[model samples]
Target: MNKRIFSIGLALMLGAAYSLTAFSQVKPETLVKQRQAAMILQGKYWGPLGGMAQGKVPYDATVVARNAGFLEALSKMPWDGFAPSTKDVKSAALPAVFTDTAKFKEAQDRLQSEVSKLVAVSKGGAEAAVKAQLVATGKTCGGCHETFREKQ
Candidate 1:
């Protein structure tokens, strides 16, 4: 089989499986917890990568790819847990997250796009390119947080 064809097929199958397993009803607290946990996972990926991007840590191509992959996957999460009921729950999420749904969604899409760019550049082992993409990704995160998250 052609490698490209196989990869496309695998992606479609995985997407279908994920869509099936991702939907469920949970309490407001659970939704808040889930989003928080997902965000923490994102931080784990971003913290080290940000350090490397900012010259605080030495860059490694292998590690950058690994963390970029994690960020790509995590970018798909968290949004699902931003249920309207979760706004007033014990969370850092602001009520505007629900009230400004389209804006919130645009930020999520921007994050996803930036993370995908990071993953693409990380594959090529270009530190400069990856660093630039990392900066873009961080800005996207900040944009969403400023509007949707309460001050900590």
Candidate 2:
């Protein structure tokens, strides 16, 4: 009885582990949806903010603060959600993301870091500084998109 129970327990454990491993692989359709959602949100906020920072549009601290909040939320997204499989890459917003994983990761890190900096600048009580940081952050966004995003 003891031997049979132990064998069953071990099998269950191994099955659970395999299940987890399989779950870590994101489906191609799911990845495409996620990327599309991320891009839309990013565009909604970053495009106007970039214009404001560049002086092509009037700067509004309130808008900047609101957009900064969105960016903070976006920065927290798990990069691992993007699976590295060939099928996932084929459907990815930027197919090159698969071929240049290291560069993509670096760009993602830069984007997150710049977003944090932008948040700090927004709350630091300096208008000019906030604008400058916004520009810097916008550059990082553009840098990543230039390499990873499909031109639309």
Which candidate comes out best when scored by TM-score? Answer: 1
Q: Please give, for residues 45-129, the per-residue lDDT of candidate 1 as tens digits.
A: 8888888878898988888899989989999999988887676677787878888899999999999999998888888856777
lDDT to native, each model:
0.86, 0.78
Model 1 misplacement above 4 A: 1-24
Model 2: lDDT of residue 80:
52
lDDT of each residue in 104-132, candidate 2, tens digit only: 89998898888988877787558889888
Q: TM-score for all predictions?
A: 0.81, 0.74
Instruction: Pull out the clashing pairs in model 2.
Output: none
Task: Locate the minimum summed-lDDT window of 10 residues in model 1.
Answer: 19-28
